[model samples]
Target: MWRTQKTLLAALMAASFTILTALDFCQSTECQSYDNVPLNAEMSTQTVTSRWKNVSVSNTVQDMDYFRVSCKKLLEVFPVDVVDGNFVRTVKNCIFSKSIPTPLKAPLRLVAVSKDVIEGVLDLDLSVTQSDHFLHFASGGKLPPGSVPLAHRYGGHQFGYWAGQLGDGRAHLLGQYTNRKGETWELQLKGSGKTPYSRSGDGRAVLRSSVREFLCSEAMHFLGIPTSRAASLIISEEQVWRDQFYNGSVKKERGAVVLRLAKSWFRIGSLEILTQSEEINLLRKLLNFIIKEHFSFISSDDPDRYLVFFSTVVNKTAELIALWMSVGFAHGVCNTDNFSLLSITIDYGPFGFMESYNPKFIPNTSDDEGRYSIGAQASVGLFNLEKLLQALGPVLTKKQQHQAKMELEAYNIIYQMRVHQLFRAKLGLLGEEDDDAYCIAFLLKMMEETQSDFTMTFRQLSEVSPKQLHNRDFSQMWALADVSSHDLFPKWIHVYQHRLRRQMNDSDLERQQRMKNVNPRYVLRNWMAESAIRKAENNDFSEVELLHRILSFPFVTQETAEEAGYAARPPQWAQELKVSCSS
Candidate 1:
């Protein structure tokens, strides 16, 4: 009986030891929360100190820990003090929480990291492994000290109707960080987890959509378009059920997250939210913060500061739409909320570059009305700007409002001028002429009628010469196009030749080279993106890496034979690929 009692005591002792060890591990590694953690708590000194000591260090032996600790302490104590004084003093109504809800599952693998963005923007020597860890912590919903995330509230016009309180449903904005150049950038995690605004969403981003965003963001940046930059991509083993088509057919998919870096995430909808809620004081304060943070060059002391701000926004919007038109890019959802206040492309859902030169192409399957079609983007941009102007009603005087309207009226003229300039560059026309617009119109009309490949057509034009018009190569190229038998085709070419002749300083070769530089040989074609997605889903990441390399230098011809397939016309099956806002 004594021996039996001793064995029970021994078993009890072992169980107590295991429980103690687990409790210690939980304290040291993961800080699981039962409720929403306060943002202030997340930015506390002790919390940041613990994270600095626990997180993995990089290979660079330059005392990065000290740098990180110093930066974190500075941000924790004086989050806005480092920013321009105007912003720190004026901004209000921002939601702050100590700790955001963590993802359902931790990141299992590091998919990709945009090294160019990290080296160029962040000025950090973070290796892929380090980046992976950082992304997992920041985007996987792991809240460490100095990593407090903010979710901004906003309203928007969706499909020409008001969408109230549509804020960052699954996005969390981590505090801003200063780069080596002293430029401050806001880092945001999309598909991190649920927020107050996630009405019915699971708040998880699937791998398919995550991959699309990761590649497209980099592709647009390299294409010389202003867009939010992607830093890293992380995938989780957790499964997320999604009705990809919103048709009630739900399926489980792999979850993922993307870390997006930008100058600011403020949008027109942010202001609209304040105005619509009758928060006049908050609206004015937020406007001041925006100007102070992003447009510091425009002095707040000036009497016409608001008017000047409106005009600058108008100009930027016009230029952005013109750029989109030049590249045949259709942003499937041009909702006011998706329209960045700084005029950079933000969300990447359902976006498409025209495979054919059809101006009426609509990429989003949900956009049945074709309101945001390629042909309608410019008009929609102006429409959204008008909504922004309305949101500023509380701040502007009647006279100033009239002035804002006048500035808004200049959008069409500005858009036309920018479009002409872009097309001129594409055609290698050194001098602007009265007939240039007509020539461009004719070329576009011909392309639309023939259903010719938009990118390839311009690229091929660079190789054609006046002397080769009657040759077999030119005949073959012309045959490939849906050319009309009418004499208008030859007439347009005659006009084009006359324009080329005036550029005596540039030889044929120089002109071709110039055109090639402006016209990209590669775009993130639907087929290519689909192939990358499929391969990634199957655990083959080689295609994603290869596509990244090719897209990095889009304007130059890739020397490898493998790239030949990417440059060719997409397979017929590519036509059935549908992308929607859910993407």
Candidate 2:
């Protein structure tokens, strides 16, 4: 009996040592696959279900379709260029160049469609989207009945210098459709083909970049950021070549197109080009038209309508950038042309959502100087606003121009206020306190030092109660565990708890609910998009469809998302990923 007891003790000791070794291995790089242990794995489905609001991915499609079958409405309203057909030349005195989309000659395949966007926004039946007519129309293979395609003509300040005649080189505006719901949507085909502005380049978008644009556009929208919508992504056998990294190594890639939707695509460059070309009369005409159509609140009779329009844009732009920061999104290209006058997320290229909290994170490989990093987006926004003010200089009175500059100056203040509100909500801090800002700053500093996952850090905080946080019990909460590794983490936690207690009658449950709403559990991380794109390039769009469905409700915890390892630590290969302005 004595020998058996000694043997049992020895076996127990050996078991303990093996478990510890395994845990240590998981903490190291060799166990990257299990980076996040999903501590709440035991939580009941009911508990998880209660956290998310029921979001319908698609509305019930009606038997009848109300899609406008042509571009006649837009053509009738806007001024046409003097030149009639597609040719590379300097365009003058026109809002748009009358051009036709050169259809893809190869066979087209409808890769994916946003049923919600079709039924909700366009008021079209879901059945209509599956038809050959829809496929051809979306891919630029066939024009809609009575369609008259037009390419917008605008110049821009590309990378802080005047880039003349940088208009819609590869996009054709297919026309405007006013849905039954009384909303107007402009349908445009990106990668449809060349226009007069397609200088020295083939008017095409490759599959890899097109996939990113399509996914990111829809993802941003569902993330509650204002953005242009993507109705469908179509792929074709048509071959296109691109030096993806701008290196000498060019590769063959399949051509693709996205049928994108927007209320209006008139950007700051719209006015800049007219002002640059000394088309003051046309500039004023365009401004008046925009004001009348989009800014109904600004009276057409008001002499200072342009000033009011400028002020509204400045305010909206500030709010937009603040929201982008809250979600850790970097647009990658914040050029004057890309910054929409409507203050929506447009021209999605080389964009990325922040994974690790690095201020100097540049998503676009072409952006060597880090001009459009996530941290610098707000400042870049100000620069773009300055260019916008300059664009409006020709139309504004001297006093109004002064007022516009003043509005531009107020941008930083407005942006800071919005950021403060958003970050406070992320921390689940109720009401204001003197130390709230400092506490928030301290937490962010610790997160940066530890290289914490930006999205999951806040999300994990939302998941854990104040008791767990106080006890430093971050087992299986991977992002929080990373952040807690900081030497000063305890000190920051004390400040945060003190600030949280200062709020009157804010229960832990209430705080959790508030934080969960603002802090999304998922974001379209670059690695996830890269995975989807790889399968898409192989003519397998299952992941694309899955990502679309998952991203449509990013706040929810779906079983499929968990099984797919989306919220898990990005795979090792993700670090080698690179995005450029090639597409």
Candidate 3:
């Protein structure tokens, strides 16, 4: 019996040592060197579900009817000039390779699909048998014919300093496809895989970030904000390790890839890289290409077309920023690289909707200095435009350069005008009065001081009756404000009532309805996203689907109490969430 016990103890000790060694190996630098792993050929043969049988790999290019893929127009329009060789080089040797579909780990499970986008923009019948195949294609698998996947070359100012040669590191532009309406849309795969521009990082996005982006993109679009739209979200069986908090704590996370649909993936950084490299001809070529592709409304034959393009961009960007402010959105990282040339909200990283009306709120924990704070977004928009103007200096004459400066100067005025327009609509103020601007300013200031729930305050105000002003019990809107704020609220309400009285053309019911239309009943709060993400992580996607449906019609009030719970104040734990660049 003694001999048997000794033998068992020895064996147990040996097994313990083996387990520790394996764990050490996984954590070691040598074992974690997956950044440069070559693509596995066998991965291409991996099969998806039988529902996606129609989306098969085609031997003949003509058979690839999943998407109406077109040839590389951007490349064709601009040949391999001196700038092409020195400045805009191919991302990888795979640029010329005919088979460019980066293999995703299977089994590929579809987490979400935008049916509205499919029927509307894609012009595909959602009830048809081929719809499943189209959705499969949208999941980052089965390349369309004539697909030319290439990583765009660009650079930008990251955090107020020049960051050189930063392009689409993990993103691949799979050419452009023309919709049924003859409008072209670019389909890009994010978190597909690594490229030459990936640097030392493993070009993979975790499921956490992918889910956030997929939902937020569509959410912004539904909110009437100019933003990129998500076609589909696909998750893999593979596990990836990520340090989500940027701290030492590392955990294995599921991998995902999101298919992002956009008008164009061009950024302000695209021109910046060319200008900084002194590639003047290439800069002009890119500018001309952009005008031809996106800004075709502006005549390219005119000599001052570039100037007009710059001014148009400025106007759009100002309006975009105003919309963001009106909706209480804080884009955590407002880096120049993230600024879209078309003035749409492109990248959704570490973004947060303002819970409390605090202008100083910074969503990104990594942003120690509130550079991209809610209050600073307007100024940052101007700063990014200034950087763009610098990039366009080579193509513009001295007077044109001065004109660009003047356009940049006009951003503030344009931004204020748009903000005032939106606020006036939200407040149901018709025909702006002399004190209209002051009244809006005073309300915002009070909101900031009282730390009121930004979205709920406006939404609740839509239901408040003019008769409720006299009764304390009916003054439920004032509950959002502090004690000091409550004391000053009556004076503000008196002014507001006077303004409403001036708008006698519309009845009180009409005024309330107008306000309700402008102010959304629900916004994508952090807690709501967290709840959906938690359930998705557990392989239960019901909540994600629920939120998707609810957010699609943000202005509509839900009939059920359970559904209305989403519009309530966030829980305590959710208020402490630390979303960063990793998220």
TM-score of each: 0.84, 0.88, 0.84
Deviation from truth (RMSD, Å), model 1: 17.0
lDDT per prediction? 0.70, 0.79, 0.71
Model 1 regions lying over 4 Å from their true place: 1-101, 126-132, 141-145, 469-487, 561-564
Name the top TM-score candidate. Answer: 2
Q: Which prediction has more favorable TM-score, 1 or 2? A: 2
> Taking the candidates one at a time, how many backbone clashes does each contain?
5, 0, 0
Which residues of candidate 3, in runs, are more than 4 Å off? 1-66, 79-101, 127-136, 472-485, 560-564
lDDT of 3 by residue, 1-583 (tens): 2333223222211121110000111233422332232212111223212213554322112222444454446556654222222122343211122213344666667788676776666555544313434434554454554554666677898878899877776777766766434567887888876655666656678787888898899988999999999877878767778888889889988878888888988899888988887878878888998898789898989899999999999999989988998888998999889999999999899999988777778888898887787777877788888899999998899999998888877776677667777887889899866677766766766776677778877877787777765343344454343422556778888888888888867898998999888788777888888888999999988877787888898888886423547666667798778888973
RMSD of each: 17.0, 16.5, 15.9
Q: Which ranking of candidates, highest lDDT first?
A: 2, 3, 1
In candidate 2, what are the lDDT values of residues 489-574, reduced to their tens digit?
Answer: 99988888887788889888999888888888878899999999999888889999999999898888889998999878778898
Which candidate number maximizes lDDT?
A: 2
Q: Please provide the root mean square deviation of candidate 3 (C-alpha atoms, Å).
A: 15.9
Clashing pairs in 1: 37-99, 38-97, 38-98, 39-97, 39-98
